[model samples]
Target: MKESSSFGNLWQAPTARRLAHATSQTSPADSHALGRLIGAAWVVVAYAARGVLRGYLGDSMQSGGGVPFWRCAFGVGMQLGVLPALLAALCASKGGGSPLFPTPRRLERWNEAWLRTPSGVWEWAFGYVFGLFFTFDLLLVPMKTNVLAHHVVCLAFHGWVFFSPQRPGLQLVIAGEAVLEFGTGGSNLSMLLPGSDAVRAFFVLAMSASNTYGAVLTVRWLRLQRGRWVWLTLLPTILGILALRQLHVVNEVYKRAHSPAPP
Candidate 1:
């Protein structure tokens, strides 16, 4: 009896519990708030970038406060939309028998909760952010300020996947994808203007290599998990990635051939 009591006492110490909790996944509120915080941060970055570029050339972007507002809305949308959808899907796995609120803590030492969370909640969020930022940047390729602002925003979120203390390992696959982006346009978050094409082109080659590396790993992992129906999901993902690549190519070609060289 005393041995068990001592064991329980030792294990349940406040520090021990806190340490354990820290290693666990975050609550939805925490995760979502962090997402919004990151989103808002990019707005500040955009404004700062605007000021910096003003000294160099034409007018900086005048978003009329639209960028920050929309970015915040998107940030909140990320968790609210995804979490409940995941909760519903996960609960339905046993024909609607799973717990309504899955525990954030893990029984094992490694924080692998993201994988089992229904609909790949964390994985999907990370990928969604990646796709969202990539598409955002691609759309703004015509405007240097817009392109630079959102690229910084995207890279900020990209680094979050691995560097964040919570569930760092959860999104290694996404990290792999993001790592590829730096080669392409990641490092050039501020490589604005036409003169950057030659430099950007070289980076693109590196980007392509990283993309291929990540894609191979991503597809294999998806297949291992998604099994036969993987194509339903895999096809769109591959096409989208390829499309982003093409967009980059077109942007570089257009900028180089069409826009005047920077002064």
Candidate 2:
């Protein structure tokens, strides 16, 4: 018992100690700067991805139902940039002494160094997502009410993470939502290159695989007990439902892509 207690103490800082460290470490400005830097990098990557995809995908890219290649590339850039970071963050947390299952302490440990501190992989992941969605919803594409609502919910949640330091695991919740966003990659690509049924089918299959991964993340997220207030959990639940609606649309698109046409 004494040995276990000694190990536990070494394993994690006390809550008061962690709280003091989180508050005293840095200003929100510093955290936002990290986020902004990450956001700006995604913009640069979007431009680069546009050039790369245009080079590789060629004229198949031109039939995007009036959506430009740049817009399509933003989705691609997000997949290229953000998914890896989220996977890395999850791996780091899981490997770095977090329990395999979701406990309150596990949740706290998952965010502590990565996100609760405001300046590491979680910031990188959130900033990249915020940049991609902000650019797509506000700058690159036409505004749809659904997209706007998801964006607002995310922004609200992001605010919660920054302001409500007591709720460190909120970042993990947002990260799960971000995984759901990554599941849209195939739909985005299919919309962008509507003429290529082969490409569309291939990416849709890829999307199914990604959504399966997201589902695993969601299961873990749902098991977490911390930061489970109605206001805290409600918006993200709505966000996931919205994502399910999009998945339905993507399913319809896939069926259309594969269906027989009139003789």
Q: Report the lDDT tens digits of candidate 2 across residue range 131-208.
A: 466545465454446655756665675565555554445545555555555556666766766678676776666666
Candidate 1's residue-wise lDDT over 1-263, tens digit each?
Answer: 11122322334445544533542355645655544554455445544554444445444332421233223233233323433333233223212122221122211212344433322323444444545544554453234554456456556545543344443333334544544544444224214322455565665565566566656545543543423654675556554665676566556556557866558
TM-score of each: 0.42, 0.59
User: Which ranges in model 2 have alpha carbons more than 4 Å from their true place?
Assistant: 1-35, 43-69, 82-106, 112-125, 128-132, 195-198, 209-219, 222-236, 239-243, 246-254
Name the lDDT value of residue 164 in candidate 1: 45
Instruction: Give Cα-based local distance difference scores for all models.
Output: 0.43, 0.54
- Off by more than 4 A, model 1: 1-28, 54-112, 115-173, 186-205, 227-229, 236-263
